[model samples]
Target: MNSVIDLLMNHRSIRKFKPEPLAPEQKKAILGAAQMASTSSNVQAYSIISVTDPLLKKELAEFAGNQAYVEQCGLFLVFCADLSRLRNVTENCGEIFHQNTESFLVASLDAALAAQNAAIAAESLGLGICYIGGIRNVPHKVSEALRLPELVYPVFGMCIGVPDQEPSLRPRLPMQAVVHENAYDTGAVLEGIQEYDETTRRYYRERTGGQTDLSWSRSMADKYRLPVRPHIKPFVESKGFKLD
Candidate 1:
């Protein structure tokens, strides 16, 4: 109901950007906000790598499915779930390092929280932002390109810059589908899905000038009918994460 809520409601992925870099102060503010995000038990197990080199950004863009915005954005940040720092600290403190699935999840969630804060701070400064999850498609290649060490893996990337194009805000599922009162409501969820399908169908059609008529359910089915990113497990394990 306020400026914060208004900003949150208008959130959208910006794929096009103006060819201008952020000011030093703007970058500092955004990163400062990210560092303040909540962490699990003070284990701020995350690291951000700002890709400033043109060649490195180009390589990362390739690793992230050739997404041009990754190279075009004024600031490209690679958020990593970094347990290496924590492990080192623990070892130095004479405590045996112990990690499992729970620790891995905590680190990933920590990175995500920090990234969201950065996105909001950037948007508040009249900057457009987009999250590039496509980096996960070739996580190993991205890690190698970034020279990430063990216990540190790229969670995702973010593109931040001035907007060159305005895109429509994508519709989300109804509140009833996501929020439940006191307990899980299966019927409400199914109803919400059914309702969202119609909204998504109309969204794609209007967005594409009636050339596309796909529903959310159908698109999700197409995406999941095939095993999506089967290599993620092996890749994460290769990074020294103990999923068990």
Candidate 2:
């Protein structure tokens, strides 16, 4: 396979990092790669905040579900879905900005795309990276800590640095369970998942030294057994996303 496809296939989240920070030029190149990602309508509705302050990183670590990697990583970047810039541009042009759910979706997609590009670029450069979705666990506190303005919300955080540990790639759902032809085959989908669950169970058992007995569907069912991040809608609305 080509290098790019090989790199994509071998992707894994790196949690442990070496203490050394990335060089200035490396940071610049990674950010440039992120900026080159495709954005909807060329709005580029995203902003990245690189946190370097020790105290702030410590606080963010606590806020992000006590993930110590946040503070230990060589670089911590928070990707924000931002529409504030567009609002300001519209105001300067003597027009009102009316944002709806579509605007929010567009900005979110933009931020996700940009962050993925940055992650790929970092990985290509021999650096390891992990995406921190726990940053959304307490969105309000994160916004307050970061001093984010209205119409801008943190989508996720990323930790990047020299790798300190090697991890096996996580298994994904079978292609037949995910990809569909002209019409979705429900029967085939169910069978595929059932087959894939066995694969996931074996992986988990091996990874955990035979201490865990979990299948993919079982783990997912437990995760969604209760409501998750129910406060996100109100929090995003408060950030001026409206999402109406």
Candidate 3:
């Protein structure tokens, strides 16, 4: 087994996948690893829907910003932040069922922890995985496709399979910028981001065959310049999360 640092440092998101299926044992082991992750108060307030149906996968692919990897990967799992189970139990026991801000945080954390463990497990087993954050583009459609009830929100999707291409390892920010001693320093943080922008621009030039001269900071600033991308406030509010 590789050391934790090696496994983490060597991580790369695999977008190209081969047409191969994981063995039953492999699937079980990956799921088991996810199940072993720490949960808030042992509530285990998350659920994973292993998508196998081709039709459903196609729909999910469209829902996730037209990411074809959803249909190409051998296993596409949707991680959900779920409070429905607890709510049901509470109601069944003749109690008031109220899910507030704290409950949402616990569910979200539980889902994120489990998904990370599953990603590591898949990587260890010689399988490639990529996280599909595009699921949030149309969260309600995703919930509908998966038949998720109220109080259960789709966190993200993971596509796991044998990789067809080995992409370069993406660069990361320097540790000095992120690791603070006792207090937070805003000036250091901004400087780190500026340095990282240059690094990312170099990486983009190398990877995309000089297609873009885009720097990370410029790209992010441009994104925020549009109102549509920032329109997620209403969508998230509709899902019952109060960012306040």
Candidate 4:
């Protein structure tokens, strides 16, 4: 495989980190790479907030479901889906900025794309990184803590630092389950998942030293079994996103 494919394939979420800070140049390079990522309609509707204050990091760690890495890592970054800039720009041009579901989707997608590029860049630099989706667990509190303004919402956070541990790469679903030709094949999809479930079960068992007995489907079911972040809709609406 090519270097890019190899880098992508060997990716792992790093939770533990060394207590060292990234060099100033390294941070610049990574963030610069993030800015180089493709944006929707050249809007670049996103912003990255680096959290360095000890008290703020501690509070954010609590806000993000007590994920210690949020505070312990060398750097913690909050990626925001930002439409505030665009709103100001349009209003200054004497045009009403339409805040609709499509606009929100575009901003969110742009933020995600930029964050993925940053993640890949960090991995290439031999730094470990983990995404903290738990930032959404208490979205309102997080927004207040970060002082996020209207038309901007925290998408997720990332922890980057020197690796303290090496974990095995997690297994993904079989390709047949995800990819399709011109027409979709229901039978192939079902069969592929059934086969892939066993693979994931084995991976989970081995990874957790048999403490967890789970498969891909089972994990997904448990995750969706409850309403996760039911406050997200109201939170987004409060952020000036007309998600209707």
**How much lDDT does each candidate structure score?**
0.96, 0.95, 0.87, 0.93
Q: Any idea what lDDT model 2 has?
A: 0.95
Q: Rank the candidates by TM-score, best first.
A: 1, 2, 4, 3
Q: Please state the error at residue 157 of candidate 1 in Å.
A: 0.2
Q: Which stretches of candidate 1 lie over 4 Å from their true place?
A: none
Q: Cα miss at 113, model 1 (Å)?
A: 0.1
lDDT of 3 by residue, 70-164 (tens): 99998999999888898788889999877667888899899999999999999988899999989888888888899887777888999999999
Per-residue accuracy of model 4 over 1-244 as CA lDDT, tens digit each: 8998999898999999999999999899889999999999999999999999979999999999999999999999999999999999999999999888889999999999999999999999999999999999998888999999999999999999999999998887788888999989898899999988899889988988999878788988989999988999999998888986
> For each candidate, C-alpha RMSD in Å?
0.7, 0.8, 2.2, 1.0
- Runs with alpha carbons beyond 4 Å of true place in candidate 3: 227-244
lDDT of 2 by residue, 173-237 (tens): 88999989999999889989998899999998999999987888898899999999999999999
- TM-score, structure 2 vs. true: 0.98
- Candidate 3 global lDDT: 0.87
- lDDT value, residue 131 of candidate 4: 92
Model 3 weakest 10-residue run by lDDT: 228-237
| Candidate 1 per-residue lDDT over residues 46-142, each given as its tens digit | 9999989999999889988999999999999999999999999999999999999999999999999999999999999999999999999999999
